[model samples]
Target: MSYISGARKVRVMARYDVIVVGAGIIGAAVSYYSAKKGLKVALVDKKYPASGASGACNGGLSYFGKSGKLLQDAYDSLILYRELAKELDYPIEICQDELFVQLATTEEEIAELEKNVEECKRFGLDAEMVSKSTLHSLIPGLSNKPIGGAIAQGGLHGFVNPFTVIYGYLDKVKKLEGTIIPNWEVVGILTSGRKVKGVVNKKEEALYAPVVVISSGFETAYLLQSLNLTLNIMPNRGVVLVTEKAPWKLKKKLMGANFGSTGQNVSLCIEQTLEGNLLIGSSQEIGVLIREPNIDLIARIANNALSFYPSLGKVNIIRAFTGVRPHREEGPFLGEIKEYEGLFVASGHGGMGITLAPWTGRTVALMIAS
Candidate 1:
């Protein structure tokens, strides 16, 4: 894009206080928070926002899914989201309707659900166990196969639409006069000696920025190669199946405790979107590049959903797609790098990227300020 300056047309050079690579939820959040801080920020992505996991998520904002610092970060992000919803121009379908329900058809799964409830309660969340009858009562069409279940009740543990969340952040960033550059892939980091300057795009265009935050999942490693930095984040594929609009309204975001029991890394997560379609997901295939829907894996995911709600047997699958979850052997690595000046890192969030996003962005922004 060029503009007229006095006599000749001048090419509009992109420059910023912070150039955030990867316009996924993490990068979007970082751009939102940084721009909110009155900084010139640019949110650049190879594709559009939420084109990754954010587009293919169940959008369960819960603290019980993780332990240790991860759990705390999830809780903190939930609180931050409450404040964020008011700031964003779009509605991300933030509803305070039902609890996060985990059902157990077997004794072992029931035991696991009980343990999860205990962990939630220990973290000061409102949680409890329910018998088989109570579980059925909570979900009228639910199968009687479940021996019991657990519930975590509170404002922080509701469900949301991931697309809106990502766009919400991006929208606010643009409203704040921050640049949203799409289809611009950062092939390498621009550097001069000890201090980093900007980023080099695939078109060989150099966008200048004093500071850079690499929040792109899996691809972060490729950008870090030139800087001699390493963040061990790998790809784990998950297939999400979309069923036809539901004939009934689902009250809770359901999880089958038999998740990943097949040892094929498939999970039993079933939820109804506000659009009335049921999103059934997923499987964990590590280090695989294939995004094609595996027929067998898709069948397993569908069968798992049917196991929970037998009534859904006739529900035709309208869509099925695979999403790559970021996998890290150790844990997610965050904060600014000491070796590279003005270069920060945020990746390896695995399947919990959306869950951990707000806290990660807030923390990373604070790091940039410091």
Candidate 2:
């Protein structure tokens, strides 16, 4: 037990086997699974659950958009999510059969979409080329500028309410007897001679544990910096626009074929939420970490949405918000630090944090449990 004394009273903090930093989807998953394996766990966050990228993303489980090792990881995560949806009491809308439409405006883009579809199929994914007429039949209000497109259907792709998923994980973690500590900003990792100790929060409270996992999204960089470790993680700001509830015209998620095209400075991805509101987003701006909504980027997003669905012009934008995603030029880092024993890192997921959270959590938990 850890104790604190003051002029008025003394308090004791519960001891834990493992301490998970960040209560977002990843951390929640780590806590839930770790506790499920009979490990005493403590989950700490600067803010409440889903206050980070997990809550801010568009909530797309784009299984079709991924390839290679990332795709394999996504497939494993999808399987885990499927089981969790049924196991959790929370109302998580896991639409596994949802269709994914990648719009193409030019013949060159159409060719690229076809190649992408073939590539997805090569990776054992269910994908096909959809003609313009077939695309219209799928999404009626879509702008007719595109000659053709590609579609991924069946169990290939889907989406979920990110907040609901995070809550579900946290609820399960609690049910497994895990402790949650919120409003505590972790300032440094506690260590002695390269072996992990625990963490020191802003209040200078030393929460000691044998294993410590840093899953604090972009903020992981700063915490590691204090320990003389540098992560290639950088902040990538993305803005999203939510529209007022309207008649849902989309039966599936939609995005430009070039949205997944490499080397693009910005891209547009749209999807209708279960609440009947359409989410228009997002732009990849490097180094802008401020959460303030940018009107200029919002306008661009609106214009891009309008270009795809003219009917979006009739929708009233309810609000605009932004989130900072931890990005690495190489991809996510998901293993123990070589120089430090009992310390692990699981951030730098960028925009795919939601999609990859389950696997990341399981991997990190297994690492600690073993």
Candidate 3:
């Protein structure tokens, strides 16, 4: 394929071993890992890297809230993220401990935390039930209203700078001779019979490849539908509020035990970033496509933050942002599709996209290589 650049039309390779759609964390990680395995890879995105949910998320690498296969997958991904934080050129700000607080009014929630801790231990995770006194010792200024809590430590929880991880992966991909195409929208998937051929861009230019991986997050469903594939990936909008840098430090990330419970209308996750800013989030609203900030949700988040940490009541909220996560009923789609020989999907991680990127990439790369 060739495109005009300035006064000249530059010609580029039309075919590659793999064509990764979307340059967000998932796609970027896939490209990096695949290229490291000596594959000629092409990564294309409608916008620049981290322009999607990867850039908007709070970057909490939490494992305690999840269980069953999801928790196992998160644990596997955490191992890779821990390694990358040390191995990569960039800093991912991986924090190791996470706290789940149970508000005093909810004795039921405190009991749930104890049960959750036991469940986590059964799954071989290091979880401990923190008494109210212990919780106070851990976080001196914490709201005494919380009866007790649980701390999921021993590398079971952490966080990363989502942008840093995305850029870091993209940089490694480039260093490994992978091609990156930004501002290119994939309009269609080009297929031959039952096998995948490549993709067509918005300009109607075709980029051929033997293998194609779709990691386009919220757009995954629409793109797959174009190829006669019915993927039920829904968009769930989450809003997060960022506060100005503060002098105080949080001993650990705080998440309400009831947050994200089924039938619950609102949820809150409060964490202090490595840069000293507090990220108060997030509300899960289903079927919201627009990425605009919701004033009500933002206010709710701020109120929740203040309720948990009274000191933050006066903190200035500098900005508010929203990210639409791709929600699938069957969890994230990974590996090749039997209907299409060369086509694969790695998406639907929802808010956990960044946290699971490393495992997703490694798994996809191995699948493609095999």
What's the count of clashing pairs in each model shown?
Answer: 0, 0, 0
Candidate 3 — which pairs collide?
Answer: none
Give per-residue CA lDDT, model 3, range 1-370, as digits (tens).
5744323333444889999999989999999999999999999999889998888888888777677888888889988887796666776667765553434337888788778777778789888877788877877667766877788776557678888888888888888899999988988777767888788775567788889999998898899888778678888888889999978877577888877564444565788888889988878877887888868778888887777778786679999998888877677889898899999999988777877889899999999999
- How does model 3 fare in lDDT? 0.81
Q: Give the whole-model CA lDDT for all candidates, comma-separated.
A: 0.79, 0.81, 0.81
TM-score of each predicted structure versus truth: 0.90, 0.92, 0.91
Residue 109 of model 3, lDDT score: 81
Candidate 1 per-residue C-alpha lDDT over 88-176 given as tens digits, one digit per residue, 9 for 90 to 100: 86777776556778887789887787787777777887778899888887887788778888877786766687788888998889889
* Poorest lDDT segment (10 consecutive residues) of candidate 3: 4-13
Query: What ranking of all candidate models by TM-score puts the best one first?
Result: 2, 3, 1
Q: What is the RMSD, in Å, between candidate 2 and the native fold over all Cα?
A: 3.4
**Which candidate, 1 or 2, has the higher lDDT?**
2
Task: Write one digit per residue (lDDT tens) for candidate 2, span 152-189.
Answer: 88574677888888888888888888889999888777
Q: Is candidate 1 or candidate 3 better by lDDT?
A: 3
Q: Which stretches of candidate 3 lie over 4 Å from their true place?
A: 1-13, 97-107
